[model samples]
Target: MVSVALPQIGTRLSASPTGLQWVVDAYVLVYAALLVPGGTLGDRLGRKRTYLAGVLIFGAGALTCALASNLPVLLAGRALQGVGPALLVPGSLTIVRSLFHDERRRAHAIGLWSTASGLAMAVGPALGGVIVAQWGWRTVFWINVPLAAVLATTAWYAVPDVPGTGRQSGERDGDARRTGLLADLDIPGAVLITAGLAASTYATVVGQSAGWGSAVFFVSTSITVLAVGLFVRRERRHREPLVDLNLFLRRDFLAANLAGLAVFFAFVGAIVYFSIYFQHVRHQGPIAAGLSVAAIGAAFAVAAPISGRLTHRFGPLPPLTGGLLLAAAAFLSLTPIGAHSGMVLIIARFVALGAGVGLALTPMTQIAVQAVPDGRAGMASAVHNALRQQGQVFGVAVLGAIVYAHQDYLTGFRIALLTSGLVLLAAAITTLLLPTRRPRPASGRSRHQ
Candidate 1:
């Protein structure tokens, strides 16, 4: 929605390129930063309760954006919106994990979740464009109002409260209960990670305008380093870390997370620029431009379920590697596109891109969940989502820089496309290196032995 509305928002708000970038980055940065804490909160509180709260917060944020009168207000609203998804995304996944105890059944459920997500990805652009075209950019935010309301209502009525780490029947621990919610939040780690990522992203986004050698850049980079360093150290020493550093020791887990991050980094970078190419270079209307990219969403909706089923039967490697390679080819195919390129070629490439995303998302999500303890499902989901959001943040910022650097839009577009293809290729190679077999679950015998 934001993508198609970027041009209009810039025009209406009298925004420069940097301002437009903030419009996107502000939401993503905050979302990525808070995700871990959000998941942990769910693990302590009930997943359903937190999910509903998130829905309300998200709706309020959307309403704020819809009513915003200036750039500052809009950015604030976007930031607020970010907070909602940080809570909701992981909570939803946690609920799914609780509901589906059987591993195979859980994979299918995850596939359905992926399918819904892909459909949203497919539908959002076109829907956003139409809303923007008909009523203005404000209306796009308005659309989320009713949708959020309905979702909250449905979740409240239809969803059951899932037991958390120590909250199961006859299993409640008095020590954990006595500690209270504040102790479980890991405040220091949360603050450090958020501040570090925000500073780092601020430096990256402003580097083009402020010059990399500028004092502002130096100050920001220095803060980023100090904060992130402290964060890693704090998490390592904390009794209950925001992100368990030990998760990375598992080869398959690391690979899946890296693969997910790379895919989003490349795909988001390309898609953001795709909107720019259509409107600025090709002179297409917002609706037309959005409809052009709808192929990706449609393909994703179709392929995600099938991929999930395949992954359930055979493990993640084949689909993960093949899907990434396929997407890379799709990115490579875009190198030939220009202002005068036919719509058929553009649509075909987008469809292929969508297929790749659908195939990878489900398996990647399952891999992340499998790598963690059953008790930490919320945390696992948060890690998966947080990394992807971070990738999206960097992707948009970096690619936006690349696009603006060149004198001609076409040259910049080509470079961006080629870069995306190469990144996906690298992701494919990384996926290939993952262990072929699933790790055996730790057994009681291991403790005795």
Candidate 2:
């Protein structure tokens, strides 16, 4: 919601480009930073308690945003709102982990979860447009209040509390009563990785704005590299690290995560630029533009569940690789679109993009989580969301830079398509390296712990 609305608000508020990016970037940075902590807190305390608290906080943040009269206030509220999701997201997965314990059922449940989120991502802009057009921008913020209240209230009763069983009666939940906070939570590794990710995201976001050759961008890039290096070093040494460094070495896990990144990155530029294409280039109003994008989301709703069942039959690669091809094809198809292009032609491209991505994304995400152990599911899911969100930030920033620089919408769009296409191709090539077989757990542990 912040991603869609903040830029419009930035224009209305006459905000600086950096400030405008901050309006969205602040939320993302904070959300990614807090995710591991949120999961650790859920593990230590209880998911239900943490979730309800998150709802209340999120509701407050939404209310604050509605009442804001300036950009800083709104950005502050956005940060608070991010805190809620940081908490709620991990908590929701905890519930899913408990409810669907079996492999088959867990896969289906995860598929439903990923598909529903994509559907909402699909619907969000349309909903935002309608409210902003009819009532006011504040209407979008106000709507969250009632929805949050209902969700929080109902969840208090309906959501059951599940306690941790201290790690199978044979393992220690923590080597210490977790020592102090830093030791208990492995704060050093988390901090290093968080800083690394934030620096990388910042570098990516500001590359065009700050000039790719500028010292600021280069310094950020260096910091990102250094932080990642330190994070790897620390994770290798620490008995309990924020993320298990070994996970990235797994063929199935690494391949699926990379594919996930490419798919989101590929569609993201098209998604952002298409909204511009729908409105500015096509001369459609906000409502029409929003609804046009909704076509992809609606198709995602149809494609996800079917993909889940399909993955069970065909394995993850066929659909995963196939979806990227569709996205690439969809982007390349738009090369000739101009001011006078037919509406049906544009819709055809979006439909192909939505359906193909739906077929690909759900299974890839399933593979990402399903490839890890159960204990690490929350962290694994966090990594999955983090990587994709990082890609989205890069997509919007880098592609938008192309459009901004060329001053020709189609040229910029084509460049973005080429870049995304190459990313998809890279992911596809990596997928080919995976052994052609089903994953079998080592010693009967969950694949995605």
Candidate 3:
């Protein structure tokens, strides 16, 4: 939806190219940075409570954006919107894990969740376009307000109350006696990570226009290094760290997350440019551009549940690898796309790309969740989602830089597609390296714990 409205946003807000990038990155960076903390909050404070709070906050943010009078206000609202998803996304997955004990049932449930997400992706742009065309871009944000209200109301009755694990039986007396809601959270670690990611993203977005040698870039780079170094050190020493670094030690967990990162980096990065190409170069209106890109989401919605079934039958390896390869082929096919390329050809490529993403995403998510202990489901979901959002952040910054650096849109678009294709190929190879056997389901005791 936001992607479809970028041109209108730029024109209305008198925003520069860099400012446009910030409009996207502001939401993603905050979402990525806060995800671990949000998961921790869910694990300690209660997933349901955290999720509800997120909904309210997200709605407020949407309202703010809908009423924004300038670019800065809009960015502020976007950041606030990020806060809501940080809490809810991991909690949603954790709730699903709690509800579905059987592995097959859980996999199917996750596929349904992915399908819902794909449906949103499918509807958002086309709907946003229609809304923008009729009422203007402000209406895009307005729609979220009522939707959030309905979701909150429905979830209150429909969703289960999953208890927090903050006070397990094995905890020491002193630890158990801590009364503060956030007593167990690693605040310093969260702060450090948030600062690090922000600085890094700032450097990346600003470097294109300011040059690599600029003081702004150098200082931001230094800040990023220092902050991330501190964050790693803090997490290593802290008890109950925000992100359990030990999770990365598992081969499956590491590989799954890496695959997730690569997938989103390619998908999110390329889609934004596609939206731009349709509107700017192809001279299509918002409605046409939105409709043109709808093929990807439509295909994704159909393929996700099927992928879940495939994962159940064949294990994650075959379908995951196949999807990555398919996506790679789709991306590479677009390297020859020109301004005069037929709409039918472009739409076909997008459908292929969408199917590949839909197929890969469910299994990738299942693998990541399955690798961890049931007790750490929220944290695991957060880690996977955070990395995926980070992928989006970097995707926008890096890919946009690549596009902007070239003299013309066509050269840059081709180069970007080629880069994305190669990345997907590498991800496919990584998936193949995982063990062939399916991961065993969590034991009864572990599930109850």
**Candidate 3: lDDT of 411?**
95
Which ten-residue region of model 1 has the weakest summed lDDT? Answer: 170-179
Return the top candidate by lDDT.
3
Q: Write the per-residue lDDT of candidate 1 for residues 1-449, one digit (tens) a residue.
A: 88678889999999888788788878877888788778877777768877988999999999999999999999999999989999999999888888876556677788888898778877888899888878899898888889899999999889987756646456432114555645566888888987887787777667757877899989988999999999999999999888888999888888889988898889876787887788889998877877777788789888888887678667788778888988999999899788899988788889999999889888888888778876787888888887887787678777777777899889988888888899989998988667786533434553343
TM-score of each: 0.92, 0.88, 0.92
- Score candidate 2 by lDDT: 0.74
Q: Quote the positional error of residue 258 for candidate 3 in Å.
A: 0.7
Error of 3 at 268 (Å): 0.8
Residue 381 alpha-carbon offset, candidate 3, angstroms: 0.9
Candidate 1 vs. truth: CA RMSD? 4.7
Clashing pairs in 1: none
Q: What lDDT score belongs to each candidate, Candidate 1 first?
A: 0.82, 0.74, 0.84
lDDT comparison, 2 vs 3, better candidate: 3
lDDT, candidate 3, 91-169, per-residue tens: 8888888788777778778888888877887888889888777888888899899989998998888987776676455
- Model 2, 52-91: lDDT tens digits are 7778888998898889888889889988987888777877
